[model samples]
Target: MGSNLYDKVHIRHLKKLGDLVPDVHKAHQGFAEAVMKDGVLSVKEKELIAVAVAHSTECPFCIDSHTKGAKKAGASLEELAEAVYVTASIEAGGAFAHSANMHNALDEAADDALYRRSSMEHMKKLRQHAPEPFDAMMRFFQTATAEGKLSVKLKELIAVAVAHTTECPYCIDIHSKAARKAGASDAELAEAILVTAYLRSGGAWAHMALMIQAYGEE
Candidate 1:
């Protein structure tokens, strides 16, 4: 599946929403607007993380675009390389560190909860300042659902998995209930999540393969 995520552009966290659907530019914008408030991590660091994620997930568009974005956010070529190297290091590190069937399960679960809550808070804050992000959000939703051939349920599940992984509890609760009510069962929902997880892991494997081949040069 990671082999299929062929994005070549890199966007900030907000840009991820836009990248997923591409029609509702504001869906991307709203998300970006909300998350920008945190100001905890430097913009460069955030963009760097996004780029690393794109690399892991095989989002070529994200990788290319975020490489540009990262530069704009103060990431140097060396820094970007280092960041991806970190991604590589962590991934390569994982290849040998296989431990539990549920790798970092407790931490992952807690991360999910945190993501849901935090995203909700961010959205809430964004709306308070912007005052009309909903209309744009709706438009983004409609375009993605109608044009992308993405099911409403699939969208909800996508939201759920991303929210969970990103630790946005508000989004998790909202999307999870929506997904289940829309007919995604426990198994279906879990499958969606595992799909997300597998893709993440498999993405690293792709990089590992690359590194293995490169190092084989000698």
Candidate 2:
């Protein structure tokens, strides 16, 4: 944010955005380093890909930054425009793909109305102060995830790294507990953290080769 781009009006608009936007300021350092080091693509393509990924992430700040980056990296206006469109399309597709998950959870939630009523009855006296409806909502999720259709263990492990990468504390807490419940070893969790760190570090160096190749052309 101390950089020049954040000075621009468009970017300022994004920084002032509400809670829905992912924290780009936190993500930028890792993002800048990650792809350049580990990505096999050119800077131009990488920026464009970042542009598309920004859309999927629903981060307006990221979108603005990557759109600028793509243009600077030699992506044409049309290319950047099309990348946004493609991003939207893929996100819309994901909505459909994820609907089954929603339906599965919803059905499970409703399937045990008697159980829900009983739980509420039990809760009225247990703790004068109790957790809100969130736990009740999560019961449906626990039930649905327990079914063999979704491997809760594997999914929890995957979700933890993704949550940390995305900087969601709630997600990190929830998924880490889930991973432990699923019997994931502390070593595996530590390994996952290292993997994210490695990816973040490698991204920057990977692009240094571009500077080398450019110099070689002389």
The numbered model that scores best in TM-score is 1
Per-residue lDDT of 113 in model 2: 38
* lDDT by residue for model 1 (112-140), tens: 33233333333333345555654565454
Any idea what lDDT model 1 has? 0.48
lDDT, residue 214, model 2: 44
At residue 26, candidate 1 shows an lDDT of 54
TM per candidate = 0.42, 0.36
lDDT of each: 0.48, 0.48
How do the residues 3-89 of candidate 2 rate in per-residue lDDT, one tens digit apiece? 332233433333332333357434754654654332333556556555555554554555666678777787788666555544443
**C-alpha displacement of 59 in model 1, angstroms?**
4.5
- In angstroms, give how far residue 152 of model 2 lies from its true place: 33
